[model samples]
Target: MLKVNKLNKSFGENKVLNDISFELKSGEIGVLLGKSGTGKTTILRCINGLEEFDRGEITVDDISIKNVKDINKIRNKTGMVFQNFNLFPHMSVLENIIQAPISVAKISKEEAVNTAKKLLKLVDLEDKINSYPFELSGGQKQRVAIARACALTPKVLCFDEPTSALDAESIKKVINIINELKNKKIAILIITHDIGFANEIGDKIINI
Candidate 1:
């Protein structure tokens, strides 16, 4: 579960997020909808501890981001999928997926690979396990990124502009993949300017 209460963030004299409040329960999809410069991505960054907020609180599975010591604790339980599909160009799909579990979670390589395979299959990227990032299409790369994020078995998943730079068919695939994750009871948070995409999958829509 994810909860953001009275959140506020600012860059010097410019305030970005103002009293942003929302709660996402297990198996629910929450979308933050707004145009560019509305601090949608900033909220996600604050939730993941990538950015320090000026005020308020973000609780992911009851672990508050406000606590300095618990930052890594919450981050381990959270996964983020960026807009550009941030995959390692030199690393193969299998390697990318297993990296976090092995390095951060301290899981064995054998176990991590097994989990990676399952996640790759979930994202329909099993066949591309040996392929490099450059060899895949945008949609394929996005799926790979999703598989990598899910490899950690995170409690909360955050996606930034998930449907960006994809065709209609690709968007449909993403929708299906997100729905599958939701069925598995992972709390999902997404920020996008696409109203149609939000309406299609979001259980709760928060406007900025």
Candidate 2:
């Protein structure tokens, strides 16, 4: 459901991603494994429309990132979970998850809340619904971020260093959650330095 072909990007004279190509299909987990500064995260940024590439084509579902007049069109088809779990510090967990759906998707507050509840339950954070980002642990925050991303019902999901700050147990939880998402047929792309984690969950591992 996601394709990146001949992708090339550079900052001034320094090239980051060069001719990178990959395809991630529905229900498949594709891992981008590399050391720091290997453009793994850059790839994610390009796919999500956060960074414009110098050359290449990126399409999520059927929407091309470059051709879309509105970037939100491509964004709506993809979900991104950042390494730092970029939750709104001021909003409660339930509010954070429901924000995108109600604001961008134009769903009613009641509908958004219902969807958020189901997502929180999926992430095993139902009881933390009223909690703020500061009140939660690192793992809990990440789970909330995941729920917020899924609230949009994206066709593809991108994760940047999902297991970065978590402990072994938390890593396992994330693995399980990602596995469950795969069953839901959401094309998954994970940018991780953890080779072991990648090997365990990735259907196709790409080294950059």
In model 2, how large is the Cα lDDT of residue 191?
A: 90
The residue-by-residue lDDT of candidate 2 on 109-139, one tens digit each, is 9999999999988899999999999999999
lDDT against the true structure, each candidate? 0.90, 0.90
Where's the lowest-lDDT run of ten residues in candidate 2? 64-73
Work out how many backbone clashes candidate 2 has.
Answer: 0
Tens digit per residue, CA lDDT, model 1, 1-208:
9888999999999999899999999999999888789999998888777888888878888877664345786888889999998898889999999998999899999999999989888888888999999999999999999999898888899999998889999999999999999998999999878889999999999898
Model 2 ranges off by over 4 Å = 67-70
**Model 1: CA > 4 A from native:** 67-69
lDDT, residue 72, candidate 1: 85
Candidate 1's displacement at residue 32, Å, is 0.8
- Each model's TM-score, in the order given? 0.96, 0.96
